[model samples]
Target: MLLDTYGRIATDLRVSLTDRCNLRCTYCMPEEGLQWLGKPDLLTDDEIVRMVRIAVTLLGVKDVRFTGGEPLLRPGVVGIVERCAALEPRPRMSLTTNGIGLARTAAALRDAGLNRVNVSLDTLRPDVFQTLTRRKRHDDVIRGLEAARDAGLTPVKVNTVLMRGINDDEAPELLQWALDHGYELRFIEQMPLDAQHGWQRDDMVTADEILTSLGGRFTLTPEPDAARGHAPAERWLVDGGPARVGVIASVTRPFCRACDRTRLTADGQIRNCLFAREESDLRGPLRDGAGDEEMAELWKKAMWGKKAGSGLDDPVAFQQPERPMSAIGG
Candidate 1:
């Protein structure tokens, strides 16, 4: 197990396939985009699979999520999912995509052993979508979500980030839309992860504000903490019953004590925390002919030094990581 001195064990792994994305969301990057990873710097497909193999077989990682600047943009992404799915004591697998190409590949991805998908979508309005993402592909994202659901990607989750004076007013409408479509809606607070370093605490929409907005339209009953267990989102039963909504208050309500996730960058560096300042290089040693046990040891050591919290609580002391959310594999 990837155990830390704080008595936390990391069983979930987020592997960034590439730092390249098709959309330039204002919250994520500049419109022109940051410099992408050189092909030589990215881990090869084999290396990625081998690392996952070690984590699942040796380190007890039970859940694997492939993220990226946009994971669907990665070449042979389906093949990577297929390879990872073949491991013994198979881990549950999912993808976090911007949903640009998902319509065309969701079925293939599902067939390739991907369990489900979490698509990033901020608004249902086309003009607002374009403004937020700097892309005119709102229709494509809708098509992609439909494709994901139709392809048997059960419990298709939608990840939405509300920016103040932007799409923050659409929370209730978004949740209502999600419930009508059988998709799980998760509203996340905007964090200081943008490349522009322009995020302000006042500019972010808090979880309380979201629930308050929804309260005007519907009743929300909180789900028990046991049901949430290590999950980032604190859920609520909408209008009472099976259908529920979630809010990931990473900023206002940090869930660090029960954190069970470890991250691997596209370049094969281990990130024990999303807001971490340092990374452990596994690619260097892997390319140097390191064995499975050695690689696993490196991963364990990285998690062993995991931070107690994301440190976003202290405004003065908390420094944003040099890498943006895209580069750091949000």
Candidate 2:
């Protein structure tokens, strides 16, 4: 396994296929969106396949998740997934999506070898959805969730970013709704990764606040630690429900100690941490015909230099990454 200096193993790789998104989520991107990278700057489908192959075969990566500005927006998404599925000792394949286009693509994605999905949904109310995403197709995301479920992506996880006054009070409703539909819910504390620099530490609804809201509605008990170390969310069981709810308290509670993941940007830079100030250029090396051994060393070297944790909890030294959430491939 690839080990960092702090003795953490690197086994999960999140690869971003593109930096283009259809929705203009207020928390994720600017209303106008970004000037996307041109095609040539992106890693070709073949390049992505080769890198993942090296990570799995040489570097001992076991989980491969595709994230993006919106992964489903990429034209070659299915092909990219197919390549990962073909890996020897096939890694668990997954994706994190906004679910706007998932209604049409979910089945194809599953058929192409995606094992599961985590869909980002802030609100079930149409008006609230429109307010958060600045989009009119709230029902489309719902339909996409249905499609993914029907395609055998069971226990479909919902990632909801919570704000102090916006949707924070909906914890019970969201939890009950998720349990009712057999969906697992995870509430993420709003972080300072927004494109518009609108994130205020005071505005974030913390994990404690979410649990407090749920506590008033139902009996919740903390789930045990995951067998695989350092799961991002803290899990809990609803007293009478079959499905579970979780919270990724990234801002208030950091889990950098057990992070076994690294990230690959759509344009081919490798990031050891989501909030990393520096990136290792893999595109140049790959294009120059670097062998797997060489490329793997680059990845290993990068991981070796990783910081202890995302130092967001430190008020005096904390600095938000230069790239916004969309560019960073959450």
**Per-model TM-score on C-alpha atoms:** 0.99, 0.97
Tens-place lDDT digits, model 2, residues 70-158? 99988899999988898898999999999888889888888899999999999888988888888898998899999999999766899
Model 2: how far is 17 from its true place, Å?
A: 0.9
What's the lDDT for candidate 2?
A: 0.88
lDDT of 1 by residue, 1-330 (tens): 999999999999999998988899999899994888999999999999999999999999999999998998888899999999999989999999988898999999999999999999999999999999898999999999999999999789999999888899999899989999999999999999999998899888999999999999999999999999999999999998699899999999999999999999999999999999999999999999999999999899999998899999888899999899998887
lDDT of 1: 0.94
* Collision pairs in model 2: none
Please give the TM-score that candidate 2 achieves against the real structure: 0.97
Off by over 4 Å in 1: none
Clashes of 1: 0
